[model samples]
Target: MTFLQALWHYPFLQIVMLAGLASAVASGVVGPLVVSRRLAFMAGGIAHSVLGGLGIAHWLGAPPLLGALLAAVASALLIAFASLRIRENEDMLIGALWAVGMAVGIIALAQAPGYSVNLMSYLLGSLLMATRDQVMLMLGLNALMLGLLWLSYRPLAATLFDPEFAALRGVPTGLLYACFLIVVALAVVVLVHTVGLVMVMALVTLPAATARLGTARLPAMMLAACGAALLAVSVGLATAYAGDLPAGATIVLCAALLYLAGLLIRHLMERRRRRSA
Candidate 1:
């Protein structure tokens, strides 16, 4: 059957599409800030560290997502607080936490007898495997995150671009920075189910980076990023269905290709402008 037929005949496919749309919107809105503030490495740390939570959650037979949320928030807060107080060797500190988190997760999961069978899905993700309930939960969480971001856009931008000036103006730059990391953590949690922890960084950064190639304005970048992300997700989903490929890998690959194409276009534009000048 055709891709459209499959989407129409399957409720799970609808859920996958909805989840992608929600992810695209969230990533588009927050991606520029992440890139602007140079938080990509930190975001990667938080994303991979979620494995620790999954390990414990699986051991206790608890919900993995809940465990991931708790662990991610805790990790983000710890890194945020420490980096604020201890400016020395902050990169080393983050790296340590990153390693520890991933090690703990791997040890826990490895110890679980006969658990390796399903581990691939969590590590790589399969959006189609999500139930209706899981999709609804993702949608709700995305809504809450987006609402918080929308309400604090200006102050957040101030902090992101100029923390010192923002603090001088009593914009609570420290608090805002921490809050932004928390939101990044939340986004990581959402993207985890979609793209898996290992590849989440690509999904979070690629579309936004591509958008940055065309515009310097934050609002325009966000809009373009959303459109770019939506295009990637839609094309990826269709390609995966047609090619019988893994959804997460396919989506990430598509986004990467799109980013490379955008980069080339931007380079060409720059060359033309220089020639004209």
Candidate 2:
């Protein structure tokens, strides 16, 4: 049977596809900001810090995604506030926050009972376990994020390029930063189920990085990033089904390979241009 037939036959596969598409769109949309702002390390910090939230939720028998969202948003806010105050060497502040957040999470998890069994699943994702409800939730969150971005596009662009100038123009840069943080936090929470915390940063970064090579404009870059992410997820799912590989690892590896391929293609094109010149 064809892939479409398989998808139609297996409701679970359909759920996976929907979740993957939602994740791809969210990652693509938020990723460029992270890359453009040199916030890759900051994003990593936020991802690790979310562990604390996860631990707390697990200990209380609540949803891990809720905990992660709370923790991540707090961390993002703290980082944004610190960046405003520090004025210099913000990376150091972000790194410190990252360590503190992860340490807290580890300690909390250690105190919680019977939490180790699914620890790896949270760290590395388990796509097979994703439910239809979760997929629907992810889609809703992605739509909300896209809407927020659409509403704040101009200020966001200004803030990303020059926060001081944006503020001079009465753009409320701090509030905008906070809003972006919230969106990132939500995206991370939605993605935790399918991408996992350990590998989440890659899914958010690689597609944007690969897409950056194809375009200079923000809208074009976002489009390329979304395309790259979709390609990675689709191909990764196919490979996992065909070869019976671990789904999360397969997806990440597929994205990494695509990034490498894009780099190679860019290099070849550059060489060809040089030869013609």
Candidate 3:
């Protein structure tokens, strides 16, 4: 059967589509800020750190998503606090957290005998396996994220573009920055089930990066990024279904291709502008 037929006949496929869209929306909303503030590495660190929580949750027979949420938030907070006080060793700290979190998770999962944990699913996600409950949870979390971002848009924009000036203007740049990290943590956890921890960074950042090549305005960039992400997700899902491939990896590949195309378009635009000048 064709992908459209599969999507129409299978409830799981519908859930997967909804989850992907929700994830894309969250990534689009926060991705511009992530790229603007150069927090991609930090986001990666937090995303990897979620493994520790997942391992422990698996060991305890609890929900993996809960564990991932706790670990991601904790890591984000730690990194945010340390970056504020010890700006010099920020990358070092994130690197340490990333390694330690993965190690801890591996050990925790190893301790749980008799239950074979599907590391592949967690490491390289299968959106086809996404459940209705997961889609619902993703929708709810995306709504919350959107509300928070909307309320703080101006201050967040100021902080991203000019933190010192924002602070001078009494915008609470430090607190806002910390809160933004927490939001990133939340988004990472929510997306873990959709894209997996290994590839979450690409999904969260690539769309915004592509959009940046075409527009300098944050609002416009976000809209364009969302469109790019939606395109990647839709095409990737259909391709994965048709080819019997890994959905998460396919989506990342599609996003990468989009970025490369954007770069080429930007280069051509620059050449045209120079010629006109």
Top of the candidates by lDDT: 3
Top candidate when judged by TM-score against the true structure: 3
Query: Which residue pairs in candidate 3 collide?
Result: none
Q: Write the per-residue lDDT of candidate 3 for residues 191-265, one digit (tens) a residue.
A: 788789899999989999999998889999999889999889998999999998999999999999999999998
| Model 3 residue 243 lDDT score | 96
* C-alpha TM-scores of all predictions: 0.94, 0.92, 0.95
List per-prediction Cα lDDT, in the order shown: 0.85, 0.83, 0.88
Ordered from best to worst lDDT, the candidate numbers read 3, 1, 2
Evaluation by TM-score, superior candidate among 2 and 3: 3
Model 2 misplaced regions, further than 4 Å: 1-4, 85-89, 113-116
Deviating ranges (above 4 Å) for candidate 3: 85-88, 273-277
| Sort by TM-score, top down from the best | 3, 1, 2
Per-residue lDDT over 103-200 for candidate 1, one digit per residue giving the tens place of the 0 to 100 score = 99888888875547377777787686877777777787788788878888899999989888998999987788788888888888888888888888
How many clashes would you count in candidate 2? 0
Candidate 2: tens digits of C-alpha lDDT, residues 85-166? 6564667876776677667777777777773646777788888778877787788888888998999998988988898989
237 Cα displacement, candidate 1 (Å): 1.1
